[model samples]
Target chain A: MTRLAVAGVGAISPAGVGVSTLAEATTLGRCVAAGPISETNVAVLKKIRRSAAITLYAATAVEEALRDCGVSGFADCALISGVTNGALNFSADFHHTLVTEAKETASPTLFSESVLNAPAGNASIIFNIRGPVYSIIGGQSIAIKALMLAATLIETRRAQRAIVVCAEERNELSSFCYSRFNPKAARVFSEGAGALLIEPVDERRPINPVELCTITGYAAYTIPGSPHLALQRAIDGALSMADLEAADIGVAVSDYKTATLFREIPTLSFSDCLGYAFCVSTMWNIILAAMACGGGCPVNPLFAAGLKKYAKHSEINHVIIYAAEEDGDASAIILSRVGASS
Target chain B: MGIITSHGVGVEANWEKIKAGESSVGEITTFDASPYRGRLGAEIRCDTSAPVSHLRAGRLDRASHLLICAVREALGVAGLIKPGIDVFLSLGTTLGGMLSGEAFHREVIEKGISRARISKTLDYLAHYQAVNLFKEFALTGDYTVFSDACASSANAIGHAFGLIASGRYDVAIAGGYDTMSEFTFAGFNSLMAITPEICRPFDKNRTGLVLGEGVGILILEELDHAMRRNARVYCEITGYGVASDAYHMTSPDPDGKGAANAMAMALKDSGFPDIGYINAHGTATKYNDLMEARAITKVFSSGNNGGVDIPVSSIKPMIGHLLGAAGAVEAILSIMALVEGWLPPNINYVTPDPDCNLNIVTVGREAKIRALLSNSFGFGGSNAALIFGECR
Candidate 1:
């Protein structure tokens, strides 16, 4: 399989907007953990009609990515989004109106905004991207799925470029859901959006030859009662496909559930810096990995030590991002910068 | 193939009803529909609980029931319900267990927040609905759920096809499932997109779409793999093309450019195969049917793309719009029509609108359908076209 070029990256996290804030998360420390996004930071998001906070985050992040990519026209690009749940905030509001108030009072616009693919749709409309646009929802692997789908689109020539975005909005319904799904967990539910622009690379290009951001391997599986095994299998599959051993892995962005799965490899906890956002946090992990693959690895001492070896001479890079559920749902993906065979 | 639609519980029955050319829409009985202006829905009147064995069907949401029943039938048809069977499950839905969401909301509105039921929140998320299917069949594999409104399942099927084509997975079960819930019903009604009378696609006096609920599943296996297993081959998925209108949220592009592009792309993707028939997305809405007709004409007209005038029809008139499930179910019906060499009628179609310049299937007729196209246009400007051909 051919590698895909990481044209651009964008994110709107608790610390602030842009990928720079994400790169400085360790140094600046956490500013705000979790809450509703302030309008001042995302004032232009309202241009998209009848948008909820999730759509706002998504559209804003996508706009930043498009701007960062410096591409004026991406009319033929496809948009894929990874969402934890559709905009529960708007859905609950509509439901509340339907129940408390009359069903007649339920706003159709609000109802429209609640669907899972609303963000992708709104972004497509706002950006004039008439190409393929859809949403991916299944636990945490959606980020990997989104990236895989994007790479496939580019590889198959389905689209010249693909925009991969992920967003999660927290509300009362999410709070209730969190309590029900993971009652034992105490981390505050964080929320944000992330986007990446992926394009095909020229095979015969010179200069660095293989110094492009590329997703080398990805795997998804579910193994009941042996979630650890599922995680291990996913890692093994990704590593096997990428043809890299565990020793070559520079750094891993992992949740507590996946931290121990990386036995000897150095791991960075997502919650340590940005709290626990759902799909957006996963996208952030990929963005950091993408940066590292492009030889701009974050300088955090914890991740730097383990990642520095791969950064030396910048020849052949491998980084892993993993997520799992207690019920056996697990997914793993590896990104690398290929200069030579390791 | 497995299906449970307004017509009945099996593919043959559903196909028979479509061929019989009768409107199956009825007054909404599952919930009080008097509040909404359009009180009609193509509800599943049959016994949904009879098809369950793994989970307590009666205790589950109607979405789970429909999906599980359809999947059970699909597994049976595929001869893979036994041991050592592993296939990826990919599904699409506009609303997956929104009834569960309504239930949770009602509980919150009734009792205090502290007493809100936990069971109501189980299948509330769309992803959990897929997990429920895994639990029902005791199946364990990575699954993807696409929630792109109506095109949800079509996209799912296309994704699975891509993976299989890329040698990632050999066999995959893909489809769409949605249960008619008052939440969506009221929203459509509120938007004045639901019609009180029977849906009349391509008709001069078409009002709007009528909602329906059901599940449609198909086992997609590689040709060599299926041949090795000696599996029953239904039809070959030739091409799939997806596009977004980026025009309006509810309405399609006024000129049908997105829809036309999707159709043209599908035809091109299939190497410009001779498309003998088209299963239109025709939602029976004022905007959809006209736009679809123009789109079809734009692709298949004599003046455009060296294409021929293909026979087109909308099955929504007979079974009502299943929303997300419409893609898979309609594709299944298209496959049946292809193999059976029979064309389903576009029921309740009256005087044809002059704006729609094309051959509209007004009655069931015998035709040699070698290849066909199934179109599904979803909310938020999502458009997908799938091409299926006879297995030669």
Candidate 2:
């Protein structure tokens, strides 16, 4: 079996910003109705004015991620951040601000923070991570894909461990981009971030130490359904490769944008509570999956996420399943439990 | 590795034409060129008005057009365009459908949200390009869209190779595609990287680089996967190296430390005694030419931990330059050279610069090439090198 483990996780999500708050929110089924936060004067150096969403939430998640991973800083770790827009908060607004009113006093620090890998850069700057730092953006798959890449780096022994960070702001551009597709669901517009600390599942570590059950496989489909058949093929292929039957599978994470698609399966959507934060759904599912490992009591549909069916699958040491939808598209991954005496 | 390029579309056809030293860079036929100064590019000659099936799903931009065409041809050439195979798609592009934004700008100014926002739904936006292409190609496996400027495709191909090498994906389709757009043309022009006339790489009189258009893709499969199906293998992607200049966003360091490190790493990773031919990333820019020459010199002088010096050349001179797709296209040229014993020439290397003192195969030569190294450096100090060798 592939030896993989979740070393740490970071998120700048809607669940109050940090891991502790997010975990509390998830455990208590807390829901916070919020709106887009604007960083109008975000560029000042001594004045890093962030939307309440950014400071209150993202900061908390990042701290918890570092703390969990025993990463005091970026002192000697290879940091790979999945960042979509660099200093976008600064750059995106810079042009508009300059063109509209020419505010030379606007914060350049905010502009600097707009670098694509800001979160990783921030973590690096905060912790002094001095190894290879890379930032990549692939729509919503950023977090899951980053996890896979971190695994590759560890498996190759490129670095002892890789800190994977996925942070997104509730910027107007993101909301505008998403609202273009699902115009009717404008209220679904929410913002947050998520991150993970991945390291090699060392043999020296305790066996069954919260290991990665398995990442069945991933498939990407186009927006208009060119990959319907391809998606099924990937699912069947991964199942076959694992020498398991489709029915034998228990939990799955689907990148579902809407709840109607879960027509007849036990489904849970962290998106309902977190809102549509693009990549946040994928990272949030990590926590959901971890929580479900203890046989999550059927998802309560009290949450307006349209989760009517409790299509729970049979459990055979498999506790978590997840799926995330990106721009009317999705990628699903299934993770099982790593405990012994299964 | 499978071949799919704009020279003639497929491996056999491209190989045949490239052997004759023919130039396909010509007038832009995809769109009107009245507004632009340079209207030349090697566009894929394919009828895109086919069935609206898996291949034409989500990409509604020019870059997507190039990618879909290249991917279809590549999978067909590799005989891996069938069911039961996990198709992993990776593509690289410098400017993705920015032309669409130009259109959106006009629409927003003239028409308004009904038109401007409608255009935003198109996948040409940099962030959505890869997502749309994956959807269009119906590739439902591991994939990534690299945007590391010029080295984007090389970095992408390297990643795909690793996926296959690590026994993750059985078949990986990796390459790059870019279209001639006003945004990139103006941007590069603003940077003063574009030459007024034909780009003369490694020459004293060379002014700057010329931006070109095209898409090139390769199909990488596991050695056992290839042999088990009796499929023909062009070459094994032996060495892949990546580094960053960490210097300037646009200029390469004068000494070429980053470029040299990339070359040394590629050779070392391939574990080859000597690189038969190197498909140089000859952009012809002042700093790039000198830095690449310095890099080649350092690699040759060091002897690769005890190996011999190698021959190198750049096809960018003949085809202009494919920007984000240059590395993927040149890599195809390198792989083809190893397969057919043909080295593409650096057509416009008349006045050689003393700084660039390497065997550039100025007029294009032929030899039994067993291994080939392809170099690609991009803006933002990103550099990547790939080595392809015959499957042992």
Q: Which candidate is the best by TM-score?
A: 1
Each model's C-alpha lDDT? Answer: 0.81, 0.60
Model 1 misplaced regions, further than 4 Å: A39-43, A203-212, A256-260, A297-302, A305-316, A338-341, B50-59, B81-85, B304-308
Candidate 2 structure quality by residue, lDDT tens digits, A184-295: 7664756666666655555323532233333333333333343344344445544554455555554455445344433444445555566666566677776556434423
**Candidate 2 ranges beyond 4 A from true positions:** A14-18, A21-68, A71-139, A169-177, A184-187, A203-268, A287-321, A324-330, A333-342, B1-59, B117-120, B125-142, B204-206, B245-265, B302-309, B350-357
DockQ of 1: 0.68
TM-score (chain A only) of candidate 1: 0.89
A-chain TM-score of every model: 0.89, 0.74
lDDT of 1 at B239: 92
- Counted clashes in each candidate structure: 0, 39
| Residue B62, candidate 1: C-alpha displacement in angstroms | 1.6
Question: Model 2 residue B311 lDDT?
Answer: 68
lDDT of 1 by residue, B267-346 (tens): 88888888888999999889988888888887788875433378889998778788889899999999999999999888
